[model samples]
Target: MHISAREREIINLLLDHPDGINVQEIAESLNVSSRTVQRELKGVESIASAHSLFLKKVLGVGMYIEGTPEQKNELQIAILKSGQEFTQKERQELILCSLLKEPESIKLSSLANDLHVTVATVSNDLNKVEEWLKDFDLNLIRKKGYGIALLGSERKKRKALGHLIAQQLNEYEFLSVVEDEYESKTRFSNGLLEIIKLEKLTMIGKMIRDIEQQLPYSLADSAFMTFTIHLSLAIERIIQGEVIQIDQEVLEELSISKEFIIASQIVIELEEVFQVNIPIAEKGYITMHLLGARQRQEKNDWQKESSTEMVVGSKKLINYVSKELEINFEEDQALFEGLITHIEPAIYRIQKKLDANNPLAGQIQEDYPAMFKIIQEGLSEAFPKIVFPTEEIAYLVLHFGSSQVIYDNSKEVRALVLCSSGIGSSKMLASRIKKEIKEITEIEVSSLANLRNIQIDQYDIILSTVEMPGFSKKYITVNPLLPKKEAEQIRDEIKRNSLTTEATLLRKLHNKKFKKQIKLKTPKLIKQNLEVIQQYTETVLHILNTFETISLPFIPTSSILLLEVCKQANVRGLIGDYFEVTNQLTEREKKGGLGIPGTSIALYHCRSEYVMQPVFLSFLLHEPMVVKAMDHSSIKINTLLLLLAPVDMQTGQLEVLSTISSTIIDDEESTRIFTSNNYTDIYSKLSYALYDNLQKRFKD
Candidate 1:
């Protein structure tokens, strides 16, 4: 007969009150919700029945165990021998939570009395708790006669509390609790929810979701959870008269950030909702969290100065890792973009001393020890002043590991990776599927916040690493590692749903239930399919018809070269105004290097109002000219590809233009043909590529 800590607490409480005890009293005694107490009572009744005792309850009254003294004594003995039913780690966490919640010193004897343990055991646990505090720059104080107290600034204390709460739940559980999707009755989760005030949490989560639209980029799930908790704790502590302090100087520095404006708006709303005046320092702290938060997608308005630094640092890191592993990664455009996106916010967190808190760092270390070591070395060499924690390094390894996964476009199926998984975990899972699952040729990652906006039918299958409580679309849940059994299950799923199988097609055609419907819809379906094909064909023909290679006079500088290309575009009736298009391209080029590294080409691209439509043109330089490459290194380029699209371009048109850009560098044969300066070969190659893409779309 195993008794949980809560159940044992209930029995002890009932024994003390032999007259009667109600659910409210038991809940208050255990510091849990009344609902939680009611749920735990089911197991308590079973325990009582096993002990030869009956729990009696009367309407509008109370309940108690009706049994002999010997039987009650037997139940007490079982509880005593059960030893409180808490592991060492659980006990330690509970003790830490107690210390964090208290403002003054707490005696060892008092802690032991509450946990049903001895003072000596608590004293030992305090040693480990003290070590954990040091990570947050906090200290534990103890004296001979006085009790123990945590010593730290209020800001550090709040940070420690938020981090402790986050550690108690994984990403899915945290989001579920915040969204009120379901109720989980675990001890830690329920306790933390109670402490934070669950109603307030739900309100704060909603407020943040409403405000997310004003943000430039989407917040990752982990970051969203962390920020929500931080705000909730801030409000709770503010009402309790325990306010944190930040230096005016530091606050002033933070006030210059774009996040500071958004934070101010949030604080204004908080003041209205809670009817309390939040301090200015609270807004500053909020800005700091926003600055240190991770984003799922890239923002176009990212600061140019910081982006330049990230570009330089990322290229160095990639070069170092590639050299150490003897693998060429410089040409991997996806890897380059991914590293920049991840490293930008990561450096912010590192500078702010915020922990990455990755859940899979240990597993990643075990799975790819060599790759981990090389990236660690690369980080140290690339950014000497910053120390990369194992957690951050593990995430970087996932990015590199994903870049190594070869995606075969010949495979037909597409999968969408939905969250409460973070970007790192999602990419690792996507990489696993690409490696083990032969049918999935493409994978798209999206967060739960953006799930409603996604075109659900575009993907052949949806894969998630978390439980979706009310999701309408059917999605398969798998572990991030995608073990062998899950791989086989995915294969079976794809096979069963496959439309290409002859037997399945025959069955669908011959089934009596569908014959009438198919006969009636065949004409309409044919018309719709024809319209779709025509739309795609029009885009393809427009791009190929406008694709031309021209020889340019000597242009010494990139600025002049861009002007010359725009002039040629004007002459070819591609743009309404050549000067406006030139300015747009030059402004974009100023943001970063447009040249593709290790190649004799520079990709100049822009979206402008002056452009008539999507256009792609190859310009051959009279002489090789020096240009800054994507890696910020000086390189000589003889060919420049200008890709332009209107601001209001359609999706299919933009995709067609993108296909043309990809064809230039997607393979060696395409790259050679584009750089060969042979107009006949270049035109034929692009026409065939576009035609093939259109044919594939029709087939699908």
Candidate 2:
């Protein structure tokens, strides 16, 4: 009795065009493929024939069936009838009776020819019909050339036919709308036949058929089946007046869609009409079933239902949410509301977001700053110092409040105590073990009976006096008397086992420093000259000394080379210039800012440490000094300042030099230092300030 959306559409086409509509025309009109039209028509044929309505296919054309109004009505009624008692022949006979006014009175040869059958077949059909109507005083009349006729009053015959039609329709009306193959194929293998077993599904399908006649195509068949399963279970509970535990997984899997929402609204309305308190999960299922059934009756009905206002509160909630999230509202509120209606689920999402932002937020503006801000802004005015949902807060307290054991790494490990049933002895054993094992994270004491069912995967380790099967691999056996030697061994084993792989990886570091080879040309002692260079070099050395130790691996080889160059420069009164360069380089390396500027340091090189040689260290300044060095197509340095120093020096030796350049560089600080009467005074002030600031800021 149940018809799919496409099947119903095809039937409607057939009913409107009694002359018959070809597959090509149907396909073209529906904007579907010819193959699709063919499939749809075939389904219609099966359903039509199942209901005792003859649908004859024309080879090069389409499908057709001719019937008077009475006959069509009768066929429609017969299709709705219950019981598997109607045979193919009986069905054909019913169709014929519905199609013809005086089927029994028609000549056998002519009637058989019109029906495309043999006279003998018609004669046999007449005989069966006569036997079926024996109580009505009807006899089969056979003429020499004409077909057999039923000799009965026209009024009596009409009454009998009407009664048969009503009986068939009454049974047909009760057939489940979801029983059809097209609607049930995705949900159940056997389709509607399998679904009918669920009492609620049967009722829901009937209700849908009576209301709309068919379901929509957009609502997939699987969705309908899922709805049936949930609704049926819920309806049964509701009828029995018992509260039911709805499965959360089922609701999630259903996935709220437009059809589902509409279906849910229908279910709610139905519940109001029936005065029942159906669970939300069950209501969802009923809605799907109804939508699917309605779709099967009329494909366009889905569009109408989708546009209709179903639930006001849900719609308002969706609108409110859309305003809050700044997202366009496209789906129905029912679908969206179903997602966040549960308090636990909503809280879980909030908690996850909090945890994800905890570390970064914790560092800024004290602990959990970002989390605090989000909670304050997002959750209105309920701001507690430790604000969290009840369950989450409880978990936090349980985790942090107790005086749990801490490992050497400061990690907490919750453990389980596997012991035999001896309350006093078990308590004493736990206390002793806790005292013996300095790093016991947690100790849960339980008897074997209770411990067997407990999930052991969560526990770090198990300590037991008794041997337990299945858990022997995870548990460490200990004597209940708490021997000191045994406890020490166990603790040592636990510590050894707990050592992480990262801790075990030994780094092979070479400590023997290699000295760089130097080639010198001068034979004079450059000690006094080197001492002068050392004073200038102090600025670079101070900066290097500030970052004396680095913990993280792999400082760039380029950075080390730059540091070496700065160390050799050691120019007096150039501390500010060097500080700026170093700061820029570090920032560029960290945040990829305006890259390291093209810069140069004038290093007055001093005397060599071991070799008897003269040394002059000079570095050319790279240009557009403030321009990021990384932006240059190529690095070029043309100017240089070289320093001359002695190879060796006695104690308290000093080397002083005067500028010889003809072109006076209009340098502010340099001009002041060069024009000053006392050079020591000028150098001392710059050196003191640079050293003081470097010590205070960079050192820390």
Candidate 3:
């Protein structure tokens, strides 16, 4: 029987979660109503029973699949074996490929025929495609004679094509005719081949090798492959009578630049090989790629005299990065010179162009997002000349990423930590130190009595919870659980070891503005303030007791779990008058993934008209829900933290909550609460963790 993609997805979801799920939960996950889930479940139950599986429903709980593991596998195989209907996502991909690769306008009927879908369905798919294209500054042009074509500058089209290709490049067939028994297994489609013949692509590859031999430059292996595809797409577009349009002034500037000179010579060879007239603008476009392209390190010119402007720019950028990351790099002369060499050519690349593609930009952003943002902001100050695309900034990140000293976790300081408490508190102390200090080459925890027999000269620094008499080493007292004061001591001691004892100017940037003390003059005014404080305290207590959080029993869709949480929020009076928090949550999730990258947790928060006071709710689940996060990646979320603030919450009030949440995500202490089953355990641990985080913020 034919089933919609959504139903198939729901069935698969149910299969993944053998434990029953509620209709309300399924509805939320599918972005449908509970009624819709019930209707679909009825249809799915028949399909399940046909495959010897059952969709069992409990009155108070939800629906679950009841079948043996072997039967479930069979059900999955059957589902996969059946010719599943075209999902909207797959249709969109097909639509994008056809528009980009095909030279002719794609008729609505033609697209529908290829996808085996109706014209209206194709139309709906295009609507989604059109919205997606807008992000790339591309437009879908639909007309009577010309059915539909992608309208944009050749540059943008190439970038869009590269992005699309990057996402689905694995799907294309790649052929290689390497001499004798070895060939490239990669594949490209006939449509892609039409854009640039396989021979032409091979030719461009050769041209780049020849160029590299002449110039003191070579692209990274990944960068070279990406460049070949980009050039091929450019050639394809040029052959189709579309030429790159560069601004007249930028063209004049680039024509005299070194990159443009090399591009012109390459274009000369290209014309002879392809028997096609290449545009000067196209040559200029190629020049931008050559300029921004990764340079080979074999040509070490750090000692070579750099212009004053380049050196100064490099220094500023490096300093900015060091300050933001809270790591010292100024002493690393090698890194300083390397930045100078990189910035010299990069400045030119930025000055002369708007777009320079870095194909690995997506992966880079995902891996070093924190570094990317810091460098992005740093470039703005250091260069101040041109706006840097996130792509260009990503290439620059390669230079910093290569430097090991900047992010090295092993602190140069060797020390022994002694605590009166047993291993548990001592272990917690070491963890806290590691989290805060980021320094400590070797830290061994020991009881004070054991230290009497140990040699003191072996260690340079000593951290003790109890007083140690006549210790030759520099001894510092610290907390057994968390060494808040001892962290500052560690930093100060580490700085003393450095040859030059200068500190970073931005070290104090963490400090928030101090609040003014509020003193009441009148007795009545004091009583009012006390009552207000008492009410909020009572409110928090009420929330904690009323909606401590239900550890989700099964893996449900994000929407389904969301409904369950919203029901609690409403019942507990967390929702404001005439407001349903779930409605705002559904709307917010549509904007992007609610989870942050590199973290397993997901956060759903908003300041809505539906909120009275800021309420923070943490939900635990037995299994991780496969949900889309802020980075547009699907991650298994075991814990869900919900933050609903007042519609007009004060900026400072919101920041306090945000800071507390960040601490929980950043440190493991509070994160344990998300997985905890005991209500008292969770409450005590979270409250204490929040207090510790606030204390650290004050210290900062």
TM-score of each: 0.48, 0.17, 0.46
* Best candidate (score: lDDT): 1
For candidate 1, lDDT tens digit of each residue in 352-459? Answer: 766565666776786556567778999988888888878789989888766632122113576888643122234446656776897777777765656777766556
**lDDT computed for candidate 3:** 0.64
- Misplaced by over 4 Å in model 1 are 1-84, 185-191, 294-306, 355-357, 406-700
Residue pair clashes in candidate 1: none
* Top TM-score prediction, candidate number: 1
Give, for candidate 1, the lowest lDDT window spanning 10 residues: 500-509
Give the alpha carbon lDDT tens digit for every residue of 381-411 in model 3: 9889767777678877777765655435223
Q: Write the number of the candidate with greater TM-score, choosing between 2 and 3.
A: 3
Q: Show how many residue pairs clash in every candidate, following the order shown.
A: 0, 32, 13
Scored by Cα lDDT, where does model 2 land? 0.41
Which regions of candidate 3 fall more than 4 Å away from where they truly are? 1-90, 101-105, 142-147, 166-199, 245-265, 294-300, 303-305, 363-369, 396-402, 409-700
Model 3 poorest 10 in a row by lDDT: 500-509
